[model samples]
Target chain A: MKNNQGMSIIVKTVTRVSVWLMVLYAWYIILHGHLTPGGGFGGGVIFAIAMLNVLLAYGSEFTEKWLKIRLLHDIEAASILLFLIVGILGISVLGGFLTNFILKGKLYELISAGTIPIFNILIGIKVAMSLFLAVLILAKTNIENGGEV
Target chain B: MMPTEIWLIFIISICIVGSIVALELKDILSSIIAVGVVGLGIAVSFLILQAPDLAVVQFVFEIFAVIILVRAFLKKDYHKEEPSTINKVLVGVTLITLGAIFYLSLSVFKLLPPFGQPLFETAQYYVQNGATDTGAANLVSAIILDYRAYDTLGEVTVLFAAILGTLTILRIKKSKNSQEVTNEK
Candidate 1:
């Protein structure tokens, strides 16, 4: 059944083992963004790459079955809106746009930074969804225009 | 331990060689892989320069770039065509001009501060106070997400616009004429 579409069995096996690890690592980077080097944008790109690995290994039909393009589009827009709302909330509460309003916890702690981690997460979601959606649209369009996978 | 300048020079030299190989390669796939190697070299140089944040991003970005390029290549029929005489001349001229510009830029670098010494007053302030103010151990993250968040917001907006533009341009037209043609087929 898995042999009918997409790449060979070896590629599928490797992707299956690696994709989830990639996603988990991406989330780790986003969540630990404040304490680490990689932040939202970097983690988000990793997340999108993980999804792209799935798309490439299993074929578009398999990917579309689980990940709806419409849902991804909506989520991407919502993440941007949420990021803006976070900024506006900072303005309304702290009298400045994107102000660090929340309590600053202990240094080097997981929940130390007030709004940086939150912003990181929001930006992560936004970047991941937007990049994935753009690639998916382009791939779909290419297929429609009679290009091979 | 070897000096960072030595490491940087080594990595940058490797990157230059890799880029030259990428450009000169006839096979598209091999060229793409060579380009990926150049990106990896740049990431290493970033690490040597003490920019771990940029290094991580560059590493991951290199993977995505190579993957995307390979996918795009897979979609098109492979063609091995020699550069025409006009194109060869144009490329030679462009390279000469770029080399001249780069050589001229070397003189301008001397006017700037030496490596690892930032001239900006804001840099000192950010490095000194960023951790205490933002409570983030990483100063780079603190500066990007807290101190200068407006700049990041602008960058995100640009990304959003680019994505929107791609979607708009690539959206499949579902006009009546197209629908009729598909139906007829």
Candidate 2:
């Protein structure tokens, strides 16, 4: 059972190659959210899918080794707090909560959207961490119960 | 390409069929797959309606939901409980009630302004000014992150709370045997 934790070798190989591309794509969506249809939540889910791919291909051991649950929890908490701080900054400096305070550069260009990109990045991190933690907990509990939940 | 109106009707039919298949199927895995099809169909419809943001969200969420549900199913024996008479009656009554409500909602939706027409001034302003004001090309992103950021924050909090609730409900204590085994180790 230990040896048979994941799928076949072909799947493992494909996952190994696809993981990098998938992660890159997710980041692209999150960072370019101001211009594109995909936003932080969608990008974050894509990241979760990448994590899921690793877990599915090589088992939870590889996932735990690569990305620690402690790190994910920290990211989750810190991202949310940072998001709140960004909102508070708006209230203090911009006269409203979550106000667009940054300078609006030319449209369609990256880094032009005031706080939208920041929000996207923060949401991406928070959502990715939360989803990763959820999947990890599910997998761990399933294993603990002798694969019987 | 076929006219969008015709395509929409076809898609709606597919959604209806997929849902019925999902409901009737007893095999847990098959039912899950059918539900995924329904989700995908709905996502595609969102795309057709020019809501790329909604489509992306619907598509991504559907995939994750299917994957997680499959994982949960794998952990348990797929022994579907036989429906008792009371359960059957409850389902029947609920379905009928929902069917009536759904029909009425459809009629109400038809009464609304046609597509591409804004029913509110606020929406018109957002469409006209969101890009220049928020500096985001994507109006949805501008609205979510800048215009209604407070609302988005509340939504984010709700999501976190929901996840926390799931964790709390599903939590279990370590058995005595497991504790002893750990101690021995």
Candidate 3:
């Protein structure tokens, strides 16, 4: 008997492309968050969706290269550190904790929104990288343990 | 119809359906899947509630939970067992109780103001104050980092603790034979 549950190339390709589009769109949203409703977490998730799509479509071989699990994990760790350091800088410079008005730049620009944009970028990187690592680890470990539960 | 009301109803309905599905599934795998569906549905509902931050956090947590659960289940064996009449009645009662509690809670809390409104307003006020306050346009940053820095610090610490816990539990040890091979090489 033929199993109909197997993935098809067309479906996989469509999803993969859509996911990349979503990741790009998410970056656009996050970068312009000062003027719009989109923020770090939203963009991060969108990027993660694309990563997940790639994994689902091409399996482990694709993920090993594209996802770069170890590098992403390091990025996640570093981003968390960056977030902390940024917060500390804000507190030390502004004489209070996490205050970002210390270095307000031009409004509606990429560098505007004081510390918000930087924080957003850091959070976005951390979230996206962490999620990518989690997914990769889970997928690989699942294979070692057995098939999907 | 008001957007808020419509969203509220949507969230409530999703919750009800999700809970019922999660409770009623026979197999453990099926139940977990149902819960995963519930989680995603709730994450969408969080978006509708205008709590995008909460929604994102929920989305991430759900992904983590589902991955961990699936991995755990894969490592362990599972079986489908027949449900007895008592079990059915208990489940039904439990569902009804939970449903009633949720309905009452939502209905009772009419006109609950948005949580972040004050924070947003504070950021605006600070902006008007000029250089005295940080000039970040993102009000959330001002509040999160400046006004509530200690809280953020504590939260980060808690996150670190949690990560450490997860790593400890999840990390696998290399075999001595592998270690010897590596040493020889």
DockQ of each: 0.53, 0.55, 0.22
| Winning model by DockQ | 2
TM-score of each: 0.88, 0.88, 0.67
**lDDT by residue (tens digit), candidate 2, B2-31:** 587678889989989999988887677888
lDDT of 2 at B89: 80
Label model 1 with its docking quality class: medium
Candidate 1 lDDT (Cα, whole model)?
Answer: 0.84
Query: What lDDT does model 2 reach?
Result: 0.84
Ten-residue region with minimum lDDT total, candidate 2 chain A? A140-149
Better of 1 and 2 by lDDT: 1
- The residue pairs in collision within model 3 are A97-B145, A97-B146, A98-B145, A98-B146, A101-B134, A101-B135
Q: What DockQ was computed for model 1? A: 0.53
